[model samples]
Target: MKRAGPWLRVVAGSASFALPTILGIVILNFLFLQLLPGDAVDVLAMRSGSATVESISALRVQTGLDQPLSGQLAAYLSRLAHFDLGVSTQYHLPVADIIAARLPDTLLLVGGALGLAVVLGLLLGSVMASLAGRWIDRMLSGLLMLIYSTPGFWIGLMMILLFSVKLGLFPSAGSATIGTRLSGLAALYDKAAHLIMPMTALSLFYTAVYARLVRATMIDVLRQDFILAARAKGLHPVTLIRRHAIRNALIPVVTVAGIHLGNLLGGAVVVETVFGWPGMGRLAFDALLSRDFPVLLGVLLLSSILVVAVNALADVLLGWLDPRILTE
Candidate 1:
């Protein structure tokens, strides 16, 4: 049989990084739970009815809340080994089920927002690069900065105020209206309308970063010797850029784009909350307020995995861009 290959090495590296993150997160979370000046037991008892100290003690035991840090961590790892993330103490539901229910909406919101940002940003960036230091470039650069500095929630709020409240253009909040009549396409339309504000807020923030990066890269490429040589050979500007500049310039952007995925995911938190979009961010917000341990752990784990995956994808892309880039 052939020896285990580079794929195994990749898996091992990913696992090595992920394990420490998991340990650190679990420890910090445990400490926070312990140090927080609140009585979860009393809260649970009050909420569940038939309030009693004994019942609260029993509930604490069930949640492993009575255990020491080491013991609780062992139990957490033991359950994690079998892919059991446990139940949410607050919700009386399986943590995985709750995450599964919410993940698609979260993915949809982030994916749509990112897709729009990258496409528009790249196009506008190319235009700005072509225009160089002209008025068009200056105007776009200023606009991009303004968009970048604006907080996503604030932008979302302004959009809602203008588009939903003043102009009556889009739905103010939620994924869809509760009682609005709808057929197949009409239902899709309503959902899209609901997505408009949050998506726009997200896209606008990311666009400036992308545009600036692309413009700088193109400018750098324009100064290269090969580009000048191609121009001297009487090549069309389009042909010179397409044949030499864009190909080389894009390699760096690929890595940058992959790294930006993490930023996009982080930004989704505020955007989701602002628009009342049903996503992991909203779930995480609620979990934090309720101190729902299981759900919180699951979200942290999932987000860490995604961030790592994007970085690994970037490494793979670097290899694609230039085969000389090597890692074991």
Candidate 2:
């Protein structure tokens, strides 16, 4: 019970900090979106073939664009207080509804990419650490460096060219095969096929980073006094690494993963756009091009929340892994 008290305090402190930060982000996002030139009315007017000045003015009035910025902001805040994300100016649908439709796709893509990167990273990093300063380690290091240096979008394009265009093994773009309906395992298989290229592209660079981080950290951990003492006790090499080196080395990796959770989510924007996936990233791209403030704001708010939640989770995990953090 005494040990749990510190954990509770840490959680409480994190929540208290996160709530105000999220509110600030919400306000800033709204203001920045408003500052962008052109409003929904102007976009509508441009799209309409024969929109007259009077028609545009009437549209502005209808959409409440004629209202002062303060009034619009007040109305927006009120709606937000009611858990309303407002209507999308471009789609004419509720912002929440639009997000609900696309959120799962983005989650799937990001989650899959992160999982793949972590798994591959830990495995390769362990191997590299075990072979430190050997030819295998040097070669693997070079390969990882190359992957780290390459841009994710370029990797995606190259993968698409090789796997989709040249060999026709996986889909080049999209979440599912168009005009084809499948259910059960078949449906899952098709989705996985579509996921391959984008997921690979998204995961590769992060995997390289994690591998390098883990390798370096593990090597450092292996040199620690505890590790040396354990070695002097005649502990098996594999058991020593498994029980001690990996555990301590993982702390930094966990921190890195948490810090980069937002980056991974943001990177989905590029990957989704490239693959024509019907996810939040692609939705955001469309919203930006169309100056759809409602959708953009919704995405920003959700993204901020996700990032905060991830960071909070990391904090809790760190506290659990090393109770010393709870004191801090």
Tell me, by TM-score, which candidate is best.
2
TM-scores of the candidates are 0.86, 0.96
Ten-residue segment with the worst summed lDDT in candidate 1?
1-10
Expressed as tens digits, the lDDT of each residue in 83-149 for candidate 1 is: 9989987788999999999888777787788778776776777788878999999999999999988
Candidate 1 lDDT (Cα, whole model)?
0.78
What ranges in model 1 sit over 4 Å off? Answer: 1-35, 39-42, 45-50, 179-187
- Poorest lDDT segment (10 consecutive residues) of candidate 2: 245-254
lDDT of 2 at 38: 93
Candidate 2: list runs displaced more than 4 Å.
none
**Can you give the lDDT of residue 180 in candidate 1?**
80
